[model samples]
Target chain A: METRDALLEAGAALLREQPVGAVLTQVKAQPVAQRAGRTIGAFYHHWSSQEAYHRDLLAYVLDPQRLLSTAAAADTVLADLPRGLPLEEVVRRAARRNFEIVRANPYVPLILALWGKQAQDERVRELLRAHYRSVTDRLVPVYRTLFDAYGLTMRPPYTVEMFAATLTALVEGLTVRAAVEPEVVPLDLPHAGDLSAAPGAGAAGAAPWDLFSATVVGILRAMTMPADPA
Target chain B: METRDALLEAGAALLREQPVGAVLTQVKAQPVAQRAGRTIGAFYHHWSSQEAYHRDLLAYVLDPQRLLSTAAAADTVLADLPRGLPLEEVVRRAARRNFEIVRANPYVPLILALWGKQAQDERVRELLRAHYRSVTDRLVPVYRTLFDAYGLTMRPPYTVEMFAATLTALVEGLTVRAAVEPEVVPLDLPHAGDLSAAPGAGAAGAAPWDLFSATVVGILRAMTMPADPA
Candidate 1:
């Protein structure tokens, strides 16, 4: 890899472990240089200041490849499931897989931290827009596939994009809540209703219908209808 | 008001205007003391350090009265509607009022900023938990009122608390997204479907159905069912 790529990858690896608010100050040139197997001179040779380096680093982290990997993993979970699963099952599997994927990804906190940073940094704001655009692009197809398999279509006035955006926001929002109040947003509670029954009609049984999954199932059912057999 | 109350309120007012991430360092002793019209010694008399003052500030802002006010406003929007409105209308009105209330509030940024700060500050985390509890307490009654008016009830496994939490997260998450990318998460668009029609049946016309409202409508519809007339 090129020196720039090496530095960014190293910086991201370092950032993965650090908490969100205090990331930029920790991005020292010498340490990043050492991690990249380059010198301080090389760091400045590429970027003039820490601000400039941080900008490039934001762009680097927002790379579509890194951003879409988690989505892709979630998609695989859905795809691997057997055909003809009930609507509730489909949503539950997707939500649980998504929760697990997001929880496990170290970059999630860093990315969430940047949500506030965008207010002060226009460049960071621009990078985030691009990141979200890519995220939406990747997610739209996944929704399309899921809806297709489930024999559903976007409710009128609601596009796949709308569904995708809501799901994204819910996952991010719940993750923030869960971090602070784990008891409130448990990842998997005993399924509140019968495992075989549809939502809004759960009987006492065991399944993974926590807040995240329950909400996702609700959104999915609300935003879709059976495809017309025209 | 007491000196401490005055100081905390002044700090909160100041924080309301600033953007989210760069909040803490801006919480200096001198300015807060000046704004509160007290001596810097008074600031020290109340709190030994800036960090201590900020902790108090978080607690002050998290006061249930201030936090629940927005929820109250949204509830009023629902209550003001005529009896027996369609479910979509109810959800849309509630969602639009919430979007407006949240968009207009000055303290949203500061509150959102605390989300990322929770990782490092145990007290902030505790304060947030308390704030959420109060928010849920306020919202449950609102949901019950809406559901009662509509003759709906929580689906077997879904409770009022889950709905309230999801709605709160959606607003916060979308606000963060809107701050960075307003175009994607618009507040109001020309209603895509007919004013009289339910969702999944939009004709190019006028109404308020943006991403936030649309998502809320979906969640509401999915999470509730018709009450049996026993």
Candidate 2:
């Protein structure tokens, strides 16, 4: 159990700091006597194989309790947030922090190794799906909070879940993007309140942070307000 | 040049049908006799290797013209969208259309591939950054039309361009999600106007499309109007 826990801890560490590809390489390079290999060996001994170890590793990463707890913290802090900071601002701060967590546990891409190529194992698919559903479930509340706070009525069944899924997808995408292309990130993408078409050309005198803050506020306002031509 | 074009055309088609990893296997299976290998021969003869071929393939996929054209068309529709439907309703319709376009193209994932692994080549990184810039440019006008129509008073400097980039990022995220995890994709993730967070029960009774349209109207009404805290 200790060895297994050590393996999980090590993997989680590597997933956060480097790509999964690099993680596998680093693990293989360990001395024949190091605990890293034994850690994996223990996981396989208990779980069946390295592939199974990853399945459970991902499941652990997608644990809803951990995710929701972080969100709960964010929710608590929202009460203390400046009155007019806006939901987009809230999401951005939350999003960056959340993605940092994801970066550290970059098990998402490796899950594909088991889920995509190992489709023969129905159990793997079920495990992966369950993890995904947990993610979707955990995110729904974040969207629900934003919509409700803004006085937006979430459409039933899919409203909170849908927006939740969109954010999940975006976060997942960003994780993948960071893994693959770290350069073209939030700094480059449009903010929710982008009022102009010019990239990075906030107001003539507005500093970058101010421009970004305003953009966030603006998007929440736009989404909140009436967009009808009338 | 013609052979290069032919290889690229063939490669894109193959990429659309199968995963990037599967491409080489499928290509190699093709009559090497015709391709020394025919188009393969032609491709390698002009280009250094498959990696080079792929690099160009990515360049082609990120070409701003195509992305901008899509943005322009979306803008025309959004700008001239009827007022009868609530603003959220209109955005949802647009989001659905955007998903269909991405679903239709397999090479879209290549956009991420280029983004993830091209920093070694300064030219590739610049091209990708440029592509990111171009897409944002095209999306700004759409935000402007909506923000102006909706009468949202966003602070200056963080204008339509930022919104466009943000929206594009969301769309890109959706495409990647659908490719890797279709089953988990929230049915409503691609549909934007369904921002309502109503309870999950009794959702089946309502026509989701209609409910979504109404809900966006509701959200917009809510966002624009002051929260009564009633």
Candidate 3:
């Protein structure tokens, strides 16, 4: 790999293991350079300053490609939807797959830490905004197609942008919940075989993910179904 | 007024201004003591160590009383529900009040920071667990009564526990979303008058909070409504 790429790769790996704040301060250029098998001089050659290097590393760690790839993988599964599959089933599959991807990824904590930083740092805020926009741009069309496939008309006051944003927020929120209060949000860990069985199969008796998936499908249905004329 | 209380208040105040990690490390006894207008001896007299002081501060900052008081205030409004008010209106009012409380609280970022800490720290993890339980214990009955008042029966896989947990996560998640990408989550700030108008009165031409409240109400309604026999 190129010198810049190697440094970023090392930084990303280290970030997954420690808090972003720690990575930025305590773990500096020398450690990252050593991990990349490059000297501090090599690190300085590619980046202007340690802070600048860290900023680039943050961007690389949260690259839109990671999210897009997850979306793409979901698309592949969604593309092969069995004929006449129920809308709820499709939602369950999609939600479960999305949940699994987030659960498996080590970068969630780092992404969340950066989210916390966005409140205080303008540059981080802009980076996250751009990241959100890129993900939304990529996913909105997929959601539109899914709605079209199901022949469901999204109700007024709930646009495709809102759906994509809501889904992203929900997933991110639940990820935190699972980490902090697992008993309450007992999402099942990803298993080897089928994604369908993974939602409810937990060692702990509660099927939190099953409940979560059902709620997600319900929300989607409620948002898309024609409004009742009371 | 008391020494212990004074120290906690100082810590909470400082925590709101900076990241919790910084508060945990850089802002130690002397700064907190000075902030509290007490000496370092007074700080040590109240707490065993910095970590212990932080743990107590975490408890104090996330005290369920704050949440319950907000819930209680909402209850006062619900108690005076004018006859013939639609169920959705009730939901809108309740959701809006909850959103307002979270948005107004400076402790939100601190709580989120602790949530990020939960992955690596056992004490923080347990504290959050206990916090979740206490909040759930307090809120579940209130929700049950609300659903009962509306003659709605919560569907299977969406228990009162799940509802409470999901609602909490949604609020926290949206709080972070608003901070990072305010344009996307554009929740309206709390207004002076009725909570009813607080949802949609945005100048940006898009009522993000209105959409958010509607989506939340929809999720609640869907979870509580009777199942349709296919």
Candidate 4:
């Protein structure tokens, strides 16, 4: 690997463990160099100062393509699902997938730390803005595909933009809930079509729904109507 | 006010100005005492140590009553609106009120700071958990009232708990969006029921909807149906 790539990769690994407040303090020259199997001379060869290094590190961390890969992967997974699945089942799978992706993501804690820095740093805020826009861009197509696949269109006064933003925010918000109050937002969501645990759901049985899927399905049902055939 | 109250209030004021990473460093005994107009001895008399003081501060800062007051007020405002307004209008008002309340709230920044501390501090996590519970508890009744007042009930496969949690998360998520990407999540949401700016909305004209209210109103409409009279 190139010297800069090795050093940055090492720095990224170091940052993954640091607390929100210690992001800067954790990224020192010697340790990152040692971890990268590079020298201090190599570090300075690529960057002029710690500030410059930190700026590049932030960019590397917040790069839209890197940050949004999981979400993109989700779209591919959902699109490839069996064609006959019920819409609610499809939404359930999507929500559960979303919850799992966020829970398993290694970058979440670090991304959150960067979010904390946004209030004090203009550059961080700009990077975050670009990141959110890309997020919206990525989600818009996923939502559009679901609507098209199901022959649905948005209800009056609600647009694809609003739908995308809401889903993104809902996921972001629930992830925070999961972190601090796991009971409130359970991690083990029932499979999309499972209903055996639902109370009084009858002999076929209804699986008790979770907050994430329940909300997503509800939004999907409420926001769309059958597309016009004419 | 009592010396403890005085000190805590002062400390809160001080902490509000500090960035998320600097929360701990900003809360010093001398400065807090000076701000509270109390002697250093008085500060010690109230608290055994800085750690003890910080514990109390976290509790004070996370107090459900103070944090939830704005949400509770939104409920009162919604309930007090004229009895005969259209449901969409009513929902629009509620969404707009929620957006305004969160945008104008003084404690939001500090609360977010504390949230950043949760990964490292068990106490902060516990406090946040308690805070989220109180938030849910507080929101449940407000949602119930909205449902009852409108003679609406949740549609099949949905429940009040999911609604409350989604709304709370949506607000929290959108608030973060507003902070980082204000344009995408537009703070200047149109007034509820005003459709003057809506594209091709015709003679009555429709106002351009914002991300927050559109998602909210969509959820409200999607998740609810007319109550059965039987």
Best by lDDT: 1
lDDT (Cα atoms) of all candidates against the true structure: 0.63, 0.43, 0.59, 0.61
Per-chain TM-score of chain B, candidate 3?
0.72
Per-candidate total of colliding backbone pairs: 6, 27, 0, 11
Off by over 4 Å in 3: A1-23, A68-73, A186-209, A226-230, B1-23, B47-49, B66-77, B80-84, B186-209, B226-230
- Residue B174, candidate 1: Cα error in Å is 1.8
Docking class of 2: incorrect
- Please give the lDDT score at residue A20 for candidate 4: 33
Model 1 C-alpha lDDT per residue in residues B1-230, reported as the tens digit of each score: 54323322332222223212434544566655554456677666766787776556656556666654457545665676565556566667667777767764545655555665566667778888888888777778878888888788887566787778888888877876777767777656555322323554444235757788777766776667678847
Question: Could you tell me the TM-score of candidate 1?
Answer: 0.77
| Cα lDDT over the full model 2 | 0.43
lDDT of 3 by residue, A155-188 (tens): 6545677777777777777777777667676554
Stretches of model 4 off by over 4 angstroms after superposition: A1-26, A34-48, A81-84, A186-209, B1-22, B37-45, B72-74, B186-209
Ranking by lDDT: 1, 4, 3, 2
RMSD in Å for all candidates: 12.3, 14.7, 13.2, 12.7
**In candidate 2, what are the lDDT values of residues A83-192, reduced to their tens digit?**
64544445555555566665554244334333332223465456656666776665566555656565565433334454444555555555544443354444433333
Q: What value does the lDDT take at residue A151 in candidate 1? A: 77
* Candidate 2, number of clashes: 27
Error of 3 at A84 (Å): 3.8
- How displaced is residue A76 in candidate 3, in Å? 4.7
Between candidates 1 and 3, the DockQ winner: 1
